[model samples]
Target: MTPITEVEGRRLALSNLDKVLYPATGTTKGEVLHYYAATAAGALLAHLRNRPVSFLRYPDGPDGQRFFTKNPPPGTPSWVRTTAVPHHEDKQARQVVVQDLASLMWAANLVVEFHTPQWQADAPGIADRMVFDLDPGAPATVVECCAVALWLRERLAADGLLAYGKTSGSKGLHLLVPLEPTPADRVSAYAKGLAVEAEQELAELVVRRMTRALRPGKVFVDFSQNAAAKTTATPYTLRARPEPTVSAPVTWAEIDECRAPGKLVFLAGDMGARLKRYGDLLGPLIDPDRAGRLPSAR
Candidate 1:
């Protein structure tokens, strides 16, 4: 492979990224656009401290907090902008973590806020932290994705699963479930169980977009990824999506009205348009009493 230096990388990258991000009026300069991903890597290091990063597209070390745009191993090529990672900036895991929303917004400087994973020293957070992943295979608008998020919230809530939503940047919504803070493996197990079961239940609502699909329509109750080893792109982590929007958090009230997916809920320019009018409907879903969470969710 050809070796691209940081400067060249940025230059080559901007050619592709500008078409997507459009950057704000004064946020980024054309010269540094390509190296933008690397710059965010530095910011992530400052935030995560001890977390291990997965879902890389390029070559990087284990526990690497890196991002590159090439073919990712196996499926490779993240199907988005980034192709790989060198490593997360801080490898020590300074805190109990769960990444989501606006965490990877380079323009936002990857300055994301998160609810600390709540669980015991040996427990996983998803048993209590409920999540629903709404992935659309077909082209989608930001609005449609949020609609799917709310739809899943209602469905999961009916099924006795507490559901909270977050943007995945690429064209999906992640519903998080807080477990008791156990091993990574256990959380993955619970997520898998939930995903499989959700797919089965959603079979009726799915539209036939593809034959022999993982259930059709724009949504897939994607619980299968909740394995100890399987990590969703924690909120704010850049997705390889075109234009590369960041997965961001929105109050239940802000779900609507917010046209752009990368905008922040805490302080986005237009908070009124979001579903914030409903208050944080998804918040209680994380509570054990409301969710009736179990020890063995998997």
Candidate 2:
């Protein structure tokens, strides 16, 4: 019989608890659920609450085929909150909005990597944050991203935005700037302008374009993720890598001191201690007082 447990009054039947989800590290499904159960009540939930999430499900571990789903998977519970999002040409897509622990665990049980757009479910047309995905092409790594991040930090600060940094849980860094609920197109335009400026100022280290050949030996400032339709890997979510690496938030001090790729690489096991030590490095993103307005488009 599958084990059943209650989370905040919701009874959930969890299956395949012992199934290995990260083959390289032998991390199990139960461990993943435990991590979410432990962290979701805190900063994790704050980031996900009321946001329409897209799931990258890996039922058979990292080595097996995986798929992305915007719609809540079949058999979704009646209590799970959902919102209809407008798609192209008058079409609508109903998507899951994780608002609490039970909802989080239910999704975690499916072995998913949580992703969310820049805006929340209640205000899909408006963006409350701007994001830049610093992807390092091969031969370049997070260490290289550090320099670019520092540059972008100063650039954003000049425009009155305070930037927060986090690992991509893959091979890159993500920088986010909280906004005072601006239109998505306006936010995208501002982000694009900064990306262009980064490329021009740090030409050797940065590339704003998505062209594959232009990326090698440089960091790609992926401002496109700020667009309304795109989603980013949520902070504190486990990535479907060979190991249970988390997309963990980091302090600017940590970013400045990072001299190697491994320095920024954080696994699921490190979360508890790190949380105890640093609290939420990205907490400013959620603080309404910290939100800033984007400068007028040039």
Candidate 3:
């Protein structure tokens, strides 16, 4: 495979990716992986939206010592885990490779994800999982994400779109939808339209809608970055910053009640408990029935 990046001390291993690294959060013990995965989901999504499909690698934590890569490797961090998962299904890989992809979101406090050229896969199919990224210059939580999700769901359902919800493993709730026959581009256009519609409807509530808005605290609905050519960072991707950090996956239910920066939901302690009992809400997102847009791949 092609090398993603290189860093000190880290050796990229394509085999153990699944066992070691996750979407947003970086390498960790099997016990605490999910929490990081959830926390970093949003960041992963955002990152993908910005960049192309490439494996990202970095050290661990608020201050990691080295970086990692996503290829067969000339040299990568020894601690780097290569068993990463793509965000979506695709001709090359999954459409949305949700694992290690970016440094950190450009935003102050957001766990973004990555998007690939084929935002929607070509062959088979999956659900239309989406992340409603809200720019709350100030601090934000699950409540805000859910409130937005509810509004979006209501708005979407009105248009005959049935959607589901989940935590981005971080700051926002990803509201997935089930679209029939709509192409990925159409989905992107639809989402953008929805964002514009939301902005218009909630003009009073939204501090700003367009990228141009009040500095620092304006909440904007990012729909412009929905094109398949445009990519969002998948979860577990490393941040380009000095310290090796990845977005941690979070839960929608936990978002409203909890507001701890890296407080932890998955990898908090139990894996089976969370996986078995706390299923990933984004499941429907990749479902062809729900997240799948019509056969519109280029």
Candidate 4:
């Protein structure tokens, strides 16, 4: 029989605690649960509170087969909160919503990556944030992404939007702008315009198109994440890489000073100390007073 543990007064029967989820680093399922348990209370829960989540499950680790699902897995605890999400015309998927520690840990046990759309459950068609996924192609690593991020930051500020930066936990950077409840379509259009502008101004380093051939040494500014259907990796969630890397929130000063790609890479182990020092660098993104309104579309 699997041992049951109680978290926040909720009982959970956890399994395969010793199963290695990250083969290269030997990170086990128990370790992943511990990481979520440690960090969820701080700020991770707030970021995921009301958003419907999509899970990327790596039951056999990153080296093995993986799959993405928006629908809640069978046998999900009744206590877990879920919301109906519409996709592809008439179909609606019942998705998990991590509102507290117990729900977060429950999902963490099964999910390697947690993804959420820009809009919350209550306001389905409206987006409260706009994201730019800066993906570097080959010769252009995250270091190049930092340069593009800096430029985009300035451009966003000019439009009265304050942007926050975070590592994609992969080979890229994500810049998110907190909005004042704008329609998803308007947000996407504004984001795309900025990407086009960035490409024109920094042609040597930025590419707005998704063409693989044009991406060799340039950073692709992915503006489509603002769409109602697309999801982005929730901040502070663990990414399924060779190691337990996190989509960690970062500071602008750090982004401006980063000269090497390794300087920006943060693993799960670094999060506790980082939280102690910075106390949620992305807090402004969730602060109601700091939310910005999008400029009227040109």
Candidate number achieving the greatest lDDT relative to the actual structure: 2
**Candidate that beats the other on lDDT, 1 or 2, i.e. the better one:** 2
Ranking by TM-score: 2, 4, 3, 1
TM-score of each: 0.47, 0.98, 0.54, 0.97
Mark the regions of model 2 whose C-alpha exceeds 4 Å error after superposition: none
TM-score of 2: 0.98
Q: What TM-score would you give candidate 1 relative to the actual structure? A: 0.47
lDDT tens string, model 2, 31-128?
99999998545889999988899999999988888999998799999999999987985476789999999999999999899999999888996999
RMSD of each: 10.8, 1.0, 10.0, 1.1
Candidate 3, residues 111-217, lDDT tens digits: the string is 21222433333322221344455544444444444555567767876666665554444444344454554445666766777787776776644433454545233
Regions of model 4 farther than 4 Å from truth: none
Tens-place lDDT per residue, model 4, 69-182, is 888998899999999887776476678999999998788878559999999999997999999999999899998999999999999999888999999999999999888999
| Residue 175 miss distance in model 3 (angstroms) | 2.5
